[model samples]
Each structure stands twice: as C-alpha cells, then as structure tokens.
Target: MDAMEQVGARKVTFIDVLRALPKLAPDGLRMARGAVGLVTLKPTNKESIGHIFQRAAAKHPERPFLRFEDTEMSYGQANALVNQYASVYAAHGVGPGKTIAVMAGNRPETLLAALAGVKLGAAVGMINTNQRGDVLDHSVRLLDATVLVAGRDYREALNEVDTPTVLDLDTLADGATSDADPEVCATLPASTTAFYIFTSGTTGLPKASAMSHFRWLKSMSGIGGLGVRLRADDTLYCCLPLYHNNALTVSLSSVLSAGATLAIGRSFSASRFWDDVVRTRSTAFCYIGELCRYLLNQPPRPIEREHQVRVVVGNGLRPEIWAEFTERFGIDRIAEFYGASECNLAFINALNIDRTAGTCPLPFAVVEYDADTGKPLRHGDRLRKVKAGAVGLLLTKVTNRAPFDGYTDADASERKLVRGAFKADDCWFDTGDLVRMQGFKHVAFVDRLGDTFRWKGENVATTEVEGAIAEHPDVEQAVVYGVSVPGTDGKAGMAAVKLRDGTRFDGTVMGAHLANRLPSYAVPLFVRVINEVEQTSTFKSRKVDLRDEGYAAGVTDPMFVFTGGKYVTWYPDYPAEVAGGKIRA
Candidate 1:
C-alpha cells in the first residue's frame, strides 16, 4: 500500500508485506526520516564520525542526546565537550592513524573521550572495564596506543600495565577548551579507522576488531534508520557496556542517527532495570538474551509493564523466551539481529519476525561443517550448503560491498578467512557461529561453533541445552561445555549451574526436568553446582576454564553425575569408572 511497504514486499514477499501493512506507516515514516538523517548527517565522499556528530548537533542543538542516570546532555553540549576533548587529544598528537586506548566504565566521559578521538581521526580502543591482569594488559598492548586514557576507578588496573603516557580523564576534561571542532575532522575519510572493539575472546586472548567510519555509517543507515525505526522523540535505554558493539554501534548509532536520546545505565541491574527505564521515560531499550532472562527471573515489579518502552532492539533474544518476553513486558516490536564485532555481515528482523535473525542484503551461506574439527565440510573441492532447518556454519562472502575489515592482528584475521569456500579464489569471513536456515533469508541462531561439542556421536548445542536447563524453576544460570572423560571417544556433556537464591538443587527434579526437555545423550552427564558462573563483560559465559577444569576429583566445587535416573554426588572413583567404561552416558 505504502511506497516503503511496496519496496519491502519485493524482498520479504507481497503477502508478508500485506500482513505488515498496518504497522508500516509509523515504521516507514521513521525509516524515511532516518534515511534523510543519514544523508544529512554523514558526508558522501570523505567524512569522519566527528563530522557526522557536528552536523547532527548543528541541526538539533537543543535536543537531548545523552542521558546518564540523572544527568542529561544536549546535542550542543555533548558536541562542545567532544570538541574540547578533541582539542586536548589533538594537542597530544592523537590524530590520523594513531590509537588511543580508553579504559572506563559507562560514564559520560567514556563516550565523550572516544568521540573526541574520532574527531581527531584517531582510532579509539575501547577496553572492557571488567578485564584485569594479563587480558587487560594484552588489550592495551594490542592497540599499540600512543596514549592510554583511564578513568579514576580503573587507576589500580592501569598501574599494573606498562602503557605509554597514561593520562587521567579528569585532568584532560578540566584542561580542554570547548571553543571549536578539530580541523582534522574535515580532512578525515569514511574509510579511516574509528574504533577498535575487542571480540569475546572465548577461546583465548581477545583480538581488537578494526571498525572504520564507513562501517559505522552503514550500521547507522542500515540498522538504525531501517531496522530500529526510532523517531527523534524516542529515547533508547542502554545498559550494556560501551566496549561492546551492541551498545557502541547498534544502540548509540540508532539513537544518534534518529537524533533521539540515549539513556545510559552504569551497568545491567536486574532489580533496578525497570525502575531506570521508567525514570528515563525510555521509549525503547536494547538487550541481549541473558539480560532478558535476568529480568524475567526477577520478581514481577509494578513498573515492569508501566514503562513507555514499545520497541526492543539487539541480538541474542532466544526463540524459547521470545513470546513470553514480548507478551509479559508488553513490548510491541522486537528487532532481533545477528552480527559479530569482527564480521561484516548482519541480519536484522526488519519485518518484526518472531524467533528469527531476520534477513540481510549481503550474500551469506549456511554450509555443512564438522563439529569436532571446526571446519566446513567439502564435497569435491566445493563447500556444500546445509539443508534448510539443519544447523551449519555461517559464512559471509567478502566483496567490495560487504568487505571484512577484520582484526588488527593479521594472524587472527587470517584465521577467520575461509578461502575457496564456494569457488576457487573466493573468500568468506567465517562467523564461527552455527545457525539454522529458516528460508526467506532468515536464520535461527543455534550455538557458537566452539561452544557446540560432540557427545555420543551427536553434536550438542550448548545454547539449546542451556535454554532447556534454564526452563527449570530453580536453576538461575547454566553454562554447558564439553569435558574430557579419560578413554572415552568423545567429550561428555558437563554443566556448571547456579541455583536461584534460597533454592537448593534437587538432583531428581533437575534430572527429570532435563530428561523431559532434552534427548538422552543431549542431557548433561555431569553438573557442578557453583556459586556463580564466570562471564565475559558482555555476559557471554566463559567456558574455556570450565572445560579445562574437567571432572577432576580434587576439584572443590560440588559435583554431581547423572546416573540415568537421577543426579548423584560425585566421588573419587567416578573418573576411574568413566575411564574403565563402567559408567555410560
């Protein structure tokens, strides 16, 4: 019916577009405004993020741009601050191809300083606030930063690292002047590096992913303008860390592109999330799957459904909880998406589809892969596409339109590239994710390729198992991974679990619950009751250490073994029994 809907129908089908017609007016208008905003905000030929910010600020000087807790900053005020910080950074030779390592929490200055670096055409290395010791040091060193800017709270952590020119954020803010925008902002190109966001580093040390201004602009236009469809009056609540691409690129870009307000939270708090959402008068919010689960687990609050939030955007909203989360919270639209920090491809739920990671313009493939070897399975020198609904390795073809900028570490970037994926001389960026193709270019996220392990000759998706385990009322959290059993051909399924407050783990109840939900071999063979599961800054479970610990008898954590009928306490002889083939999965 509408022009936008007519265009969209060509891609998603006319019938689905007809189904989406009623809701298209608002979304189409918002998207139209966003498209206009994108063209006006970003320079066509050569422009930096600072230029875009300046343009937006010039247009909506009085509009509220950033809200941190009780404090709010207008577009003009935020731009002034960024200008001052940019001046300081420029004085320190932090411009054009240089790197500035920034270590801070979700404070206003964190974003201000990062934007300042952007203004000066410098790449801002956003360090995870939760990282410490070796990982922290590695992140800083990997950036090869000319200057390390740190917040007061991270002083102790900075003291441990050997970085060049560590500057206090307070001093920089106090000394800088808000007179004018940096001259370098005009000279910078869209292809210039803007920021370096670290990958999850679940396997080893995190690699710094290079984000160019071109990619940021694309994210703003594609995801913000088209996918999120936020209006200038809308306010998006963001609680995730700024270091993550979800918060930095998705949430912030969406808000900025629409000239909307971004209400920032110090960090995710299950108890105070709704209260804060209400406080900010937020019309929308961003989420990961775990954040939604945490909110669902908390006692239903009066303010939960009382907020103005109509739209929820971001990735990792699982299919199992999709209906319940949307219905219970009274959320109107869920823009579930699939992307990675380093990868170029993205799939967004543009049509408000349930339980799907939407569709993308980019060319991608779901190819058969060997779970154990972590390699794509080939048929006569050609990679094979998996049947629809079957789990497979997801790869995005590398082309001029969707180029993989990759990581700062050349070796790490090289490792992710799959040459001759479909044809000779062809290259694809391996997403390292397992997803089930649902036809119509949509996909259902299955599990991280590394997280899925083989058990009883069957591939077990940890996310699927975790989803099942989480269904149990008493289970607060579950981290599933494969653990080696001596003399066993394949790894055994192990789960490190945390129970709800004041709830004790009942082996019989849990066993029965898991048995009802999962297949015989898919059920976790061992369960370790832990106080808390270790998580990365982005709330992704850290399974490498847990996998390394294995099922050692000397381990102090309370361990249990599923004896087919019920979970039983583990003893010293359990390993021997398993190795001797006495114990069976």
Candidate 2:
C-alpha cells in the first residue's frame, strides 16, 4: 500500500534492475518473434490460432488442454473435435471474411465452437449471453454473421432475436465424423480477423470489438509467455464469461502459448471459487476487482489459503486490496494488468510489481484532466501532460505497429479521441480511464473518468470512496455514485452498500469510519444498505441503475443521509440539507 503512493517517485535499486533486465530479454525476444512471424506468416498455413493449437496438439498429444468439472480434454482430443466442428461449419459457407457469431456461456463446447470457426478463417463473434430482445438483435445484426453456434441453454434466448443461420451446438456435427485438420487452415493468414469480442455493457449496449489473430498472438507473447509465464504443466483457471477479453484472450491465449491446460468454470461463484481452483489444480487464475472483493468478504474456509496458484493475472485489482488479497491467499505474484477489450496497447506486471499496472513499450500519455466534466485539460492547442505521479486522463497513440482497431459508434458515451494532443495533426485515442503515470513506463489505474463527480468544488473519485467504504469490516461491498439534489450545484456522492451477514448498519459508526478515511468533501452524502448489488456477468456493479434511483421512494432498501457529523434516516424528498449541500461538504 505504501509503495503504491511512491510508485512514480521511488528510486530504482541496482539489484532490482539487474534482476529485471535478464527476465525482460526473453519477453522482448518472444514479442519480437511474434511480430516477425505475423509479417512472415505463410498465406496459406501458419501462425493463426487454429494453427497454433494444431502445433500444440502434434507436440503434446496426450497433455490435457482443457479441464472442466466433469470433462478433461487432451490437446489431441480437443483439436480433433475442433476439426470436426470446423468441417461442419465450413459446409455452411463459413470461410475467409465470413463471421460466425456464437451465443453461449462459458463451457468447453463454447470455446470449441469459437475455435472451429477461427480454424476456417471466420471471425467469431463472442456475443454476451445476458443480452436479449433489442440488444441481442443489434449484436447479432452488427456482425451479419454467416452462421451462429448457440448452446442448448441459450437457444431459448435467441428465439426472439433475429439471427443468421442458427446451429444447435450439440447437434451441429450429427453426421460429421472426420477429425483431421480442415483444408481451410492452409488458406488462412495471420492477419485475418479472429474474433469480435463485445465490450461489457455495464453502461449501455455492448460494442463488437474486432481483433485479428495477429493481435491475439501478440497478447499471447506479451501477457502469456512473458507475464503469466505459464509452463506445459500449468493450468490457468478462468471463471469470467468467455465473451470477455480477459478469458478469451488473456487466459486462453496464454494457455495456448505455453501448450498448457485451461480450466473453465461456467460462471463465477464466490462460495465455489476455491473449490473449483483446487479441483482443477490451477496454477493461476484470472480476476476482476469485484471477484477479489467477493472472495475477501466470504468467511474463510479451510481450503481458501491452501492452493496451487502461484501467480494470478488480470485487471481491476485495486491497490487498496492488493496486499490483503495476496496476504490472505498466499499468492506469489499478481499480474495486475491494464488493457481494454478494444485497446491496442496493454500493460502487464511482468516484473510482478505490487501496486502498479506494470509497464509497456508502446507510447501513451497521462494528460491533466477535469474529472467532473470528463475533459482533458488543454493548454492552447495541446492537452497538457500530467507530471509523473499525478492522476490524469490516459491516452494511447495510434500507430501502424499498434493500431486502434476497435469500432466506435455514434451513440458511444463520447468520441474517444484527443485531437492535436501534444503536437499538430497528431490524434490520441482517449481510453476513458483516469490513471497515474508512474515513472519508468509504468501506470497505475485510478478510476474511470466517468466515475467521478464534482461536489463542493472538489472532484470525488467513486472508486476511492468505494475503497474506503469497503475497507470497513462490517461492509461486504460498496458502490459509490453521484446523484442530483434539488438545489445542489453539482452531483452529490451516494453509496449503495451490502453489509456482512449478522452485521447491523449503524449510520453513526459508519459515518465516523468514513470520516476518518476520506475527506469531508469525498465522503458519500447518502448511503443505502442493500441486500445485494446488481452486477454484470463480469462482476462490475451497474452504477447507472443505482445512481438513477438514488434515495427514491421506489428504493425499498434502507437509506441514510449524512447530516452534520452523523447520518440520519433519508426519506423521499429529504431536502433539509439540499439547500446548503452540507452533506457533500
């Protein structure tokens, strides 16, 4: 925790640098090899995901490639099924430039279906399973997929949506028996679009972000081979929805890179998490911050600390809980990385740093920003870069080497561009995230630019406030957001919290606890004790719904308002402090 604050200012030790230098050389060579392979890839037969899997199967035919609770598939077996499925898919006009949208949950078949399409040079759309009706229709139509592979459970979900040729996943290969490699693999190039991973629709409709096989390979080189550093025997446990990049690219790609095993869970279950990890004999696991929080909140079981996981990887592990999560779980390294489903660049904690999002070679900037308005602070014609250690808006440069390939729609939250950022005619892609520019090419995530609010002339970060609230022993989880008051100048901070079992919400004690941790201006003005927090499939709290229903009559949850130094019952139209906004102050 102390090192987090000193990240950008700390002096590097010679011993540490010497140790890191040797490890970096292998990563550099690995990434360079991937770059060279893409350019030199044979047009007909090499470097695609399918080709990589085939090579692994040929080398390690008997090694387990995928492990589910009831199913264990060896590299040879999985590749054979993938080929069989590919044979079936190719018959339906699935080939180069065609798209195969898959609507399913995390299962062995779900991953097999995606690989089957990619083997035939078809872009696989990883559609969100939670989506239905209009959103589902838009997602399906967005790709105009030549075919759709849907699992049995999700067939009813797609019944109402307009989709392309739908194929029942289990019944797809009814008569197909060939397990040999598909002929289409010979014609596929490395640059072909491999997948269309949709963004988590926590805010709104998800966007289909296109990713080429080359980029996916780059992630394998950077995060898999270098960061997680998986071996042939390592099993990476990934419970996140397969549609997300963390699962599909980071965890799975890393496994493929090492010719290792992949352990899949149908969905996240806090109670069953450790059990799954132990059962799969996982050496590593992917995570989001919310997943960590859920685990921390649960009463410890005997197996919680006893596990084979030496290193854990993924993004959104907040600094506040980093030490606690590691200390409790006895993890050796945490590859807390920063990258989006659509972003071209990624920062991996290859050095196994404690509090930073790690380092990258690509060019990026943390420019000064107005958190409240979500605007970059510009000086004359260019946005001003933040001094090292200062929090600011994060922007990554677009280049031929690392291109910004994600699609941006008109209805997006905002135009994700910063024109003339530092020099004339140069444009940077706004990452929509606030980050601290740690020295030596390192960056630490602060909060989302949109997850901030101006109150009493001070910008309050919701993540920071949520961290403070969640730190309390009695609180299981907390989500902070800004809400409107009748006479307030700006939005006021409000929190939706879930308390631990058998714990009572004592507003006075909670208020005092927060006051000690956060400044008066940053402390949440209103607090609601909820039975449960509504979360997306990825464990991201749905803040929009909570913010929109702030202190409203429809909210049956117990609500409290900060008044003076204590909190009081908050009723509908509570306007006692609405005039002065003393609660926010």
Candidate 3:
C-alpha cells in the first residue's frame, strides 16, 4: 500500500545501481571509473554517513529496504520509519549525545531503532541480551545509558536491569505511529557518537568503544560502499546478534547506507540458513567462522549450489575452511576481513586470500611478541618489529585519518594504548592479536596472543583445536585452553566439552576427529566433559578459569579421557603420556 512496498514487488536491475550511485557520490568525477566493479575504492573527504542515505533515498526511494519473513519495506518506507523513531526518541527525552541501550535478538526492528537513535545524535549501545550477573550490570553502567530499549520477549529477562528507564519494543511498535515529519533535534554532526560497542576486556570488565558519526560514515563509504560494492539490489542476510559490531556496524550500516535491502533472521540456524537464503533470494550474507562451520555441518543440500548469493562478507572465516566453504556454497566472493569492536586497525580481504586477514589499507606494524609470556616485547621505549614472516603483535598508528577515541571507561581505554609505539614521537593501539605479516600490508592471523601457547615445541591455536573437537556429532560445545605443566616451558592444550542432549559421547571418536585435523601436540591432552559450556555475554567461551583448572580431573565435573578407543571418566589420575614429554608447561 506504500510506495516502497510497491517497489519491493518489482525486479531489481543493475541499472538502478548506476543511477543511484551518481546521486550517492554527487561529484561523479571524484570516483574513478570502473572502481565499483574492479573492487577498488576512491578516496574522498565526506562529511557524514547520513549523506550516503540522503543521496540513496533521493535516487532509489522505492527500492526494497528490509525484509523479515513475509514482511518487507522499501527504502522509502524505511526512511520514514527511521524518521518516526527519531521523533519518538526526541519526545521521550532522548536527544543528541545521550546513550540508549538496545537489548534484543536480531530483527529488522533492532536496526531501525539503531538508525533512529543515530538520527537523534544519540549513541546506540548494543547490549548483549545473553549477559547475566556482573557483566550485564557492567555493560549498562559503562555506557551511562539513560534509557533501555528492548523487545517484549526480553522484558522479563531484563527485569533485573537497573537502568533508569526501560521501553519495550513490542509496546512501542503497537502504540506508536510511523510519523516522522517534524524536524528532529538529534540531527547528527560529524563528531556525534553513533555507537557504544562493548569489547571483552583482558582485565575482566568490558570496555565500551565510542564510534563517531564521522568514523561510521567513513566505514560505510570506504569499506561497505566501495570495498564490498553493495548495491540497491543486494539483500544482506544477517543472523548474528545485533549486539555485535559484525552485525550492527558492518552488515546493517553498510547495506542501509547503500539503500540495499536487509533480511534479518531471528538467529543463526544452521539447518534453516540456506533455505532462508533461497527464500529471501539474498544476494549477500554476513558470517562469523563458527556460523559458517555450523552451516557446513548440515548434510550437503542441492539448494546450496542453487542459491542466488554471489557474495558473502564478514570476519572470522578460517583459512582452512575458506576454499571448501566458498566453492561448496557457490559463493563467488568472500570478503573475509579482520577487525575488533574496540581496536583501530582493520584488514579487509579485498584480495580474496584463502588464509590471510588480507591487507591493511591503514598504517600498522607487526612487533615482536613473546611466545612464552604472550606479551608484546618492549625495550626502553620502542617495541621491536617482528621478522617479515613471523607471528608478532599487531599495532595500528593513531592518527587524524584513523583516530582512536577508545572507550567510555577512560582507564580501561588508556591501558591498551601505547604512546610513541613505533617511534619516540608516534602513538598506536595494541590489537592484542598475533599475526604473521605476509608482506604487501597483508597479515595471516596466527592466534589471539594470550590464548595461544606452545605445546610440545609447537604453537597451538585454540580456535583451530576447538574447531576440530566440535566436529564430533556427540559434542554440543567444545572450549579449548592451554594449561601449564610442571617443569615444561609452555602449556599443554586441553579441551572442555559439553555433550549433546541425551547422547553418550565416546572419547575415541573425538580423538580420531582431532587426529585427522590437528597435529599430535595440538590434540587436547585432557578432556573434561560437562553438561554446560560457560560463555561470555556474546557467546565467546570464558577460558581463564578453565585454564586455571588445568588437567586435574577432579577439579572439574564429569571429566573423560581416551583409553584404548573409548571414553571413560579419569576421576583423579588420568591416563598420562607424561613420560614422552609431549606436553610443555
């Protein structure tokens, strides 16, 4: 019945992008010819990300904007809805500079609300709904959130949240009108904060990173618009939680700025993912490595090779699974990228490398990292740069072009930043990730510095080991960590597993699974079977305590080990190959 809905019903054409792009980038001369197709970006000093939408809406107002199951909205309808939400926020005492926390599952409404918040010059605090206990309390408090906007289903779950005010989305949607004609006081400026994304802290408490409108807009223009080559016809499939930067900043913001359609799933469902892709006729989708592996585990289906998807973009697509995933799913491009919610540097796999985080278009350095201590090696003032091909600490220079405003918690923010990092006069942000520079600004991800350890003279990647352990059909969740062994130089890799409901797990099957994928030292020496896997607010497994528990069987519950070909509880003294010295402490 609306103008946008009518447009959604029509077939999308490539010509639409050509027409809309000129408006999106007004100075057509500014963009080099064929840059869009060649996957190269043109440099420009843009004022605001809102300019992207303003240009897009003017050019393609009627193109499909969002799709949720059978429901859909065109660009025009979405613009109007965003405006209406902006008006509502202004009416409710939420204006420029204020922080509004959004707690919900992935949905079209979540993004709509975020845009509305942005329009009001209010920063959207992406709160992980799964957070409980102290983490939940810390996230809300850190953002200095005045209002908590959440979905109806989560109202009870968030009842414990002691924020000043809470607004249920279901109630707001039912009672409020999508009327945003009035001028909103929250017109965002370049310096305006757009997002307050929380990052897991090495010091226990999470830190809230401030994302400015200028940086956000630039990301859309430089990365999403130019790098990903998003178009009006593209329907971005997002199944990750809205709380994450991967889903919020990368996927939704990029597509919305390009005036493309967005198809939001409730959550990542491996069984229904490909089916949903076909049903939505999505041209592109976002993924994390774990989500991709989950989908790959599903019985290979004919429909996978028959989908309309041409490109899939996101961070965390592992190198080992890269070729198989893309080829099997018929995806032409996998824009595998590297970034953190709180760090300055970003690496886009623009070259489409199989196992690398690709190239850093920004200024960065790889410095020497201590494999034993898992810390960056520093001398009097300067940090040592690693050899060209060795795994080292990743650092990005803080400059005007790439400013690091850091987090709301000043102390936590200051901790990771090092003054005069590369030189006595320069400053940079320590990424905490260890990467092996492959030259040409490209870096191959080795592992998370602290999470990785040397076992039997070989460095073990916890993610790689966990991936292998997860393949067992009986395993529901597997968390791998390195535990210290007496008299050894480094740690021994151990696995904490949770079995699938009602399934009896066999250790031999798990051992075979690991033996097939990992090296002898990389295989988890100790397996602790439990009923549940403890995860962080964003579903990342918490490994500090697990590592502290070490291989002491009775220290944990339901511990199991491989003996003769079957799994049996080790109790106190587990079967040990202690004599071979295969594990280092």
Pick the TM-score winner. 1
Clashing pairs for predicted structure model 2, backbone only: 44-186
TM-score of each: 0.77, 0.75, 0.73
Candidate order (lDDT): 1, 2, 3
lDDT of 1 by residue, 1-585 (tens): 743223221224447646866777767877776556445543235866788888899998999998888899999999998888888877777879899999888978888889999888899999877666555777888999988889999999778878878878887767776548887788887888899997643344567899988778778877888789888999999998898788889998888778899999998887899999999999999988667766776678789989999888988776667788899899989998888788886788878877777877778999999865578888879899986556789999987667788888788788888999878999999888888777678777766667656554344667767877888899899998888665443467899999999998899999888876565666888999999888888877877788888777567988999876779998777765655544554
**What Cα-based lDDT does every candidate model obtain?**
0.80, 0.78, 0.67
| Stretches of model 3 off by over 4 angstroms after superposition | 1-51, 173-178, 181-187, 451-585
lDDT of 3 at 347: 76
lDDT of 3 by residue, 166-235 (tens): 8776555444455553343224456667798865454534567888766665556545654466666788
- Backbone clash count for every predicted candidate, in the order shown: 0, 1, 3
Worst 10 residues of 1 by lDDT: 3-12
Q: Which residue pairs collide in model 1, if any?
A: none
RMSD of each: 11.7, 11.4, 13.1
- Best lDDT goes to which candidate? 1
Better of 1 and 2 by TM-score: 1
Error of 2 at 511 (Å): 29
